[model samples]
Target: MPLRVLSTLDAAKTQYYHFKAIIVAGMGIFTDAYDLFCIPPITRMLGHIYYKSNNSRIQPAAEAAMLVVALLGTVIGQLVFGWLGDHVGRRRVYGFSLMLMIAGSIGCGFSMGTTQARVLASLGFFRFLLGLGIGGDYPLSATIMSEFANKKKRGAFIAAVFSMQGIGILASSIVTMVVCRIFGRKDHSTNDADIAWRLILMLGVVPTALTYYWRMMMPETARYTALVELNVLQAARDMGRVLDVPLSQIAEVDLVPPSPPSYPLFSRKFFFLHGRDLLACSALWFLIDIVFYSSNLCQSHIFDIKDDGSAFDAAFKVAQFQAKVACYFTIPGYFAAVFLIDRVGRLRIQVVGFVLMAGLYFFCTYLYIKDSRGVPFVMYGMAFFFANCGPNTTTFIVPAELFPARFRSTCHGIAGAAGKLGAMIGAAGFFLISKGGDDPNRDEKKTGIEVILITLGGICVAGTAVTMLLTRETMGISLEDNEKEYEGESVQGKCFP
Candidate 1:
């Protein structure tokens, strides 16, 4: 076989454009998390306004739909945009997703009707549109950042981009808390409560709008240019411009392209080559998101709310509590992953994180069994901390690193879509499992929250085992090297060696 040639992108030193790419990509994630998590607080307030007779709470089905609908949109978006990113070019379709997000956010804010059902229908539809945009952002941002970063810092860079999710979550909580404080009245039936949710929804538009021009300004990734399109000169020029190096310097470098894959994405050869990788990436993401989205969107349900409090007061308290947890624990875990991912390696961190989270979950389950609220809450916070620090962050970074450049975004989207499916399951199932019956007010059975915690713990344990069996460490290795490694392994055996 001929030797693989490294392009300017594979060999180029990290530069200003790398960090710039992170910021541009990271901002999109910030908007995604902000928009998604903001709904939980609003849901509480919505219950009060729309269903005043039922203790100011909307039906459990409506609540689940509000969270799951976006995830459904996300799964669809990941598949569609992931394909489009590869079929067209990343930059060509990148800005369109942001525009969708802007439109969706505005639409969600304006959702109104004569009846609660119509209003919720409008809101769920708009949020689904918003989720489509957010889903598109996942593969695009991960692919863009991974392609831009040097191998030495690639894991950290991707992790940093995802870590913005922590910031987004924190921002959502903070915004909700502040909005509630300003607009919340003792009587949730008033117009002020209605305005607050709208304002919070609209707030997502600001960061997304700010990032649009910059996203448009970014050139197509050099890997996509040279390898996928076979436009070596253009790739070099774009790389030079982005790296702020002279075009002559890039031109002087040896930019031999690697041999293209011999089979199509769905062919038997392709499956043999990458099936294990796809499964590992998809399964891990699926498990992590089951807990991640469930915990995030169901915060009000998990925490103890005082029966004596008014609806507005309960909503404000929940928002405040969530903000504190995110700010203090969740956000910190993301940065911890950012700091350690490159140094410690992806698999190790993921394994350790899963193990830690499993332990925490089991402990929290025990606490729940004992009917102990305060300690379990702290343990839950700790679980979130380790999750972001470990698998939640690593699952995203690993898939972007593992795939071939041509199919990278598509594969990442598949994995991400799997995660969203899990999110949908978790979002819907959490309500069913936690409530222990169809009746929302049913007393907790032995199989209630305790069972949910135990299941999550089991998922973490299984995730840890799968990581050991299927995932390879990609730290300090160029994307090209990683691809070559897999290609070599495929040639040696029918499955990944």
Candidate 2:
């Protein structure tokens, strides 16, 4: 028997609760982006504070540890919390992730040691904890928003939540600008820079902690309640209040046991039915993040801030340049995806993003080889724009929608982990390659940053093929109907559990 509450939730018109859920859910993502992106500039400031007396930048190994440890934490968090969300309940596990984030942020801000190595080690450990929290937010927020939204506007709603990431990135730049301006001084000194980085890192908790109570207060998603928990009556009542529907409209007699059992996550039956979808989602996410995270390092190269001034001036300049990119390109790209995702369809947008990014990367390599100045910056900026407007947003949204609710969180978490894996590769690989290319004594073609960009371009081309082959169009379809369609396909192909 079909659960009427699940159907009502899928068909309900957009309402105030929808926007409220977006803000509540989106704030977690906003904090995620800020906490992740804010570190790069802060790391630069850290080098000035702790390593300046040595007459060198932060050691490459230490810097890489600082940059990548959070991504590692995110991967673990996505898998652990994602499984927990399914077994215990989404609402129950949600608060734990947020709490971890708060603790980690505070810990990083206060990270201390007598020696520079000890301090870096302490910071890395706390950031790993922070990453765990950020990772948990990924599947929980995306799946929650997806399950709660109406099918008609579901893509847009989820995209809107993901778009908060743009604001978070912007906020990172703004916060850096404000902090650097406050600490700006005429002479070279580590004291002010040390205070500024700690304050900046600690401030990430403000918006995140503010949303904690509201996140805890949200009702369990009706889809999860009825379809997963088998609590039809409670689902009906909760959604009734949220959607402003009269309880009488959903007949009490219609409350019944969920029928047509779906295959469990990772089972043989699920493999036959959803293996392709799962593979596509994971691969696309992985491929896109390779380019996306790699591009993040391009800011320093693209903007090319001269190191002639005080470290404070350089931090301020980096923040200003990043802010300009966020304002002009990155943030706009996110909202553009939000506005058009429901209309243009997820698969199409992703293919477009990959194709455009591949072309842009190739163009960037060409520009770099030509020794061109003043133009590669725009090329790199456009690459960022399309990544957000296309694959980055769509990859997050697709996994949440394409899987059955039983396996939704798990599958989304897996795909998200794959993306972060790609991010780790991108961050580490780009760093190594860029380091080699910048060596005054090295001239190998293989070690050049241009080669890395071209390799990324090639990866994007492969992503386009993989996306088209693996993923199905999910636009404008209810979650239940999507589940049913998969079952029908499996049956017609004579696949059985």
Candidate 3:
């Protein structure tokens, strides 16, 4: 059988809109990382301000909720917005997610009440809403960017969008450092600390709000137009404008309209075709996030390996240290993935990342058990570096690439939702496990931390195995062809090839 001709989107040369889409979509991811991560440094600060006693740290349950609540919201948001992106249009529902984020961020900043319980509840509620917006961005941005990008550079483009996450992490640290420096020098009052946390949370609004207009202006993806909407002419025109190519160029191609699946997304037939792929995407993401969020949310505290000076000073020092590591090491890993994803291929990168992360975790565990200080810190940083350059990046990129366009956002949402579920467990479980640190039992606390580290290593090993068994390499394949090959039918007609 002859190969089916590619559509305008797949065949189009790389152009300006690709980069434009990257920035527009990338900023959303940037906001996500910033909002999600900025909380860790301030968790203690909130305790100081609201509880008004240095000894009164956030309760283990409340702290876990604070860390994981947004994840719950993200899971819901990903499902709702992902389906909306498919059923309505990607452009139509895109900006609303940011709007939700803006509101949630501001609400978090203003979170206040007569008692600590009220304040914690208020903050958690708003962060959950923010998570919803962040969740929506996952599927919408990945799907839109994937559809807009040419096959030749799709992996790099998608990974490039995700790399913004590294920048967001850096920004979270820098902003925290600057805020602490400004506030820490003057008055160490609870009120001052309160103001500082609010400032940090509210700062998330700037980048998200700035991108809203550009996000609204982005045209619907050509593939969504052609295949999902069955409007070949409009898809061609949209592609022509975005790619800066003549309509004649797009017009010359023989376009095939995608066949409406005979089965619904929940049908056995659909499951048979995509169930393995969905499981691969979801489970791999789940395993990756378990390690990713655990390290990320707890790093500042982990680096506080020794009992230090004043509580305020100690917290400030930890934030600054974490920020510097993120700036110097973590951010670089993201760009490395962006550079190597297309060149080295997604599966190889993910496999390498998981294996290296596991090895690094084991190394860190050994160092922790032996009371080796500086080296463990270095290994932890290296683990973070590999996480970004490996599974963290590929898990995101692969789901967008492997799914059928008709349900692309929905599938991506499911995978993203699975990841957030893992994040919730990692955040909440780590909080519970590490509660041993506060106990009079020093050995127990040490054992708890070591166990967490070893467990993360095991999770990474499991991730590597799942990737090996379940997923297919998607390097250099056009999105349409990838879907058609998987579905085993022509795009337009139902006839099996």
Candidate 4:
């Protein structure tokens, strides 16, 4: 029998807590974006302070280590924290990730060393810690939001949570610009701008720290308490407090589960039931991140703004350009996903995004092959728009909803880990391609960039095929219905109007 509390949660009107939940959960994402995207500028600052090179670019080896370490930590964090979320409870494990983020941010900012190698090692260590926290947030935040949201607007709520990413990126750029402007010296070679990078790195803690208290205060998701733990009374009480509803309405809920799964996670029965969905979510996420992170991480190099002034000035300009792109394309695409995800359906949106992204990648490839010197900001921006509105948002949302509450976080983490692995690949590949210098017109550099774009395009085509063939639409459907389908039971009715 379906629990009455679950029904009420799925049918509850938009409440104050819903918005509060979004803020608390969304801030984690905001911090995640800020920390991840803020690196380009910091690397520039590092090159200036430590590398002692005329061009002020860090060595290829140090740059790759710094860039890819967090990704590695994130992958491990996702798997570890994801399993913890299911085993220990979401609320129980959620605060720890935030704490790690706070520590990591501060540690990164305070990295101490007399030598360049030691400083790089210190920074890389802290960043890996930061990535762990950020990775944990992905599965926990998405799963919590999905469980709390009413079925009717679940897509919008989840998308809204992910949309904070755009805001975080904008914040990173703005903060970097402001810091560089204030601390930057007229002389391009001075160490005056050293503090600017530290400040930018540490400032990510504010949003993360702000949300930590509220994150702890959040009740364990009702689905986890009731469905996973089989504690209907606690679930009812938690939701009662959250939704501000009377306990009497849900305390009397039916306790019988209509054939809940008895299999362990990743067992044969579990795989048989959810294997295809897992494959789709993981594969699609992996594919999208390759395109997303590579382009995002290498934005400065791709734009190849001529060194018109001081190194500090160049850093500020890069920040401004990033902010402009975020404002024009990234932010809009995220909000568009928020508004249209439910209306258009996740499957169609993802498929369309992949197709469009493929076309744009091919076009960009052509432009690069033609040795176009001008920034293809229009094509690049359009790609960002579709990506945010399409796979990036949907990849996070679908994994949360498709699996049972028992394994939801674990599955989401696995998918997220897959995505991060792709990110590591993309970041590594593009950084290598651009490692030569800032000159986009360099013959060898142009060829490498064109090859990467073409590869991304081909991946998108594969993503489209995988998405269409394997994914399911969870729109306008209750979480319980997903469980019912897994149980091989006939769904009696839709829970949402």
TM-score, one value per model: 0.93, 0.94, 0.93, 0.95
Model 4 lDDT tens row, 281-316: 899999999989988877777777554555577678
lDDT of 3 by residue, 347-381 (tens): 88899999999999988888888983423667788
Best-matching candidate per lDDT: 4
Clashing pairs in 2: none
Candidate 4: list runs displaced more than 4 Å: 185-189, 253-261, 436-441, 485-487, 490-497
Find the candidate with the highest TM-score and give its number.
4
Q: Which stretches of candidate 2 lie over 4 Å from their true place?
A: 53-56, 185-188, 260-262, 372-375, 436-438, 441-447, 489-497
lDDT of 2 by residue, 1-497 (tens): 45677777778889999999999999999989888888767766776777776443555566667768999999999999988888888889999999999999999988899988888889999999999999999999999999999888999999999999989888988999898877784356677787788888889889989989999989898888877888878887887777778887654574457664656667888887788888988998999888887668445643445544555776677677778888888999999998889998888888898899999989888877776453367788898899989999999999898877778888899999999999989877776776612245434432356778789899989988887777787887678754563655432111111
Per-residue CA lDDT of model 1 for 215-258, tens digit only, reads: 99999987777667777778777877778567776663565654
lDDT of each: 0.82, 0.81, 0.81, 0.86
lDDT of 2 at 136: 93
Checking candidate 1 for backbone clashes, the offending pairs are 47-56
TM-score of model 3 relative to the true fold?
0.93
Q: Give lDDT: candidate 4, residue 302.
A: 77
Scanning candidate 1 in windows of ten residues, the lowest lDDT window is: 488-497
lDDT of 2 at 396: 97
lDDT of 2: 0.81
